[model samples]
Target: MKTAEEKKTRNTKHQKAVLELLKNATKALTADEIREKLADNINKTTVYRMLDRFVEAGKIHFVTGQNGKSFYALCKSCKEEPPKHIHNHLHFQCEICGKVECLPETLKVPQLDNYTIRETQLLLIGTCKRCMNSTN
Candidate 1:
């Protein structure tokens, strides 16, 4: 039987692998995309669960595509307390290629007197430079 420490180590290893995949990705990726790149064959359900855990832990954020498909990206400004994750950044989706990328800039959240904002997602859709250049 595996000891508690061994099990924790195994779990951490898997989590690190998943995080590494997201960190290296230039574009947001679906669970399938992440799974395809992993060296080990991790279960689809496990991938989804890991994604959820990461989101809750403020390590990543999810963006829903125009077609309703969800993609995950790493949170560049994650914090441990107060605001666990920052969602002020904008996401750009290439309408032609259906690729999603996180822009380096951030948007200011409007202040409401009696409202507490949990998160905000802004998705901008357009033909990316690569696609536009390719068409010429």
Candidate 2:
């Protein structure tokens, strides 16, 4: 357990980063992006540790990438966005570009009725439009 000051500091830092990245991000980004943006000020270990808290706090979501590392993004704000979150939007992972995007208007993830739903994540692997068009 951390002290109150520590917890507060952690919350402020993580929340700021989460919102900053989410608002600017087109899709999900890996820890590498975070480190790149913040540099030495944001240690990789700190990012991972803070990510855990953000996930638990329902501020962020995670998905597995082709590289096997867990990619993360800002959680769909249950308030402004549709409740169909968790796994609502289908993911589009670019093969050549190696970018993961949340296809909001695309994949319609089924919402299971019954029982409590805790977390949801989806992965759609394919070549992105940019990559596909480039191939042709």
Candidate 3:
């Protein structure tokens, strides 16, 4: 017997919580990780739907892990008002801990003779500093 407005409001609350979680995350998180961190214990379907909505809104982006798992992270280059998605930096994945993070350094796209480059996805895989330091 819940009204449409009530359902929409609930969805909005969940969306906000997801956004806040991603905003505070240092590394990209998987859907399972996100679900575990949420206080409300949202269902898997609802969590995925929320993530899809955020991706469509351009408020966040996904990086594919080595095992084909997708990790979601906040869009640092996206504008708040219009939510334009612009990714110029590369993604780094730590082999030891399996954490993915966006690198702050932008790539210097090299010019080709004639080919036009519309987009690029560069993922660097190696042991992250935290793992390297821990092993030493």
TM-score, every prediction: 0.86, 0.73, 0.83
> Candidate 3 residues 30-127, lDDT tens each?
99999999988788899999898887777887878898988999987655333323466889999999999999888776768887654457788999
Candidate numbers, best lDDT first, in rank order: 1, 3, 2
Model 3 error, position 79 (Å):
4.6
Candidate 2 TM-score versus the reference: 0.73
**Local accuracy of candidate 2 as per-residue lDDT tens digits, 58-107:** 66777888889787777564443223334555676887998987766544
Greater TM-score among 2 and 3 belongs to 3
* Clash pairs for candidate 3: none
Please give the CA lDDT of all the candidate structures. Answer: 0.86, 0.71, 0.84
Off by over 4 Å in 3: 79-84, 108-120
Model 1, span 68-87: residue lDDT tens: 98889988665544363558
Model 2 segments more than 4 A misplaced: 1-11, 80-85, 105-116
Highest-TM-score candidate: 1
Model 1 Cα shift for residue 112 (angstroms) = 1.8
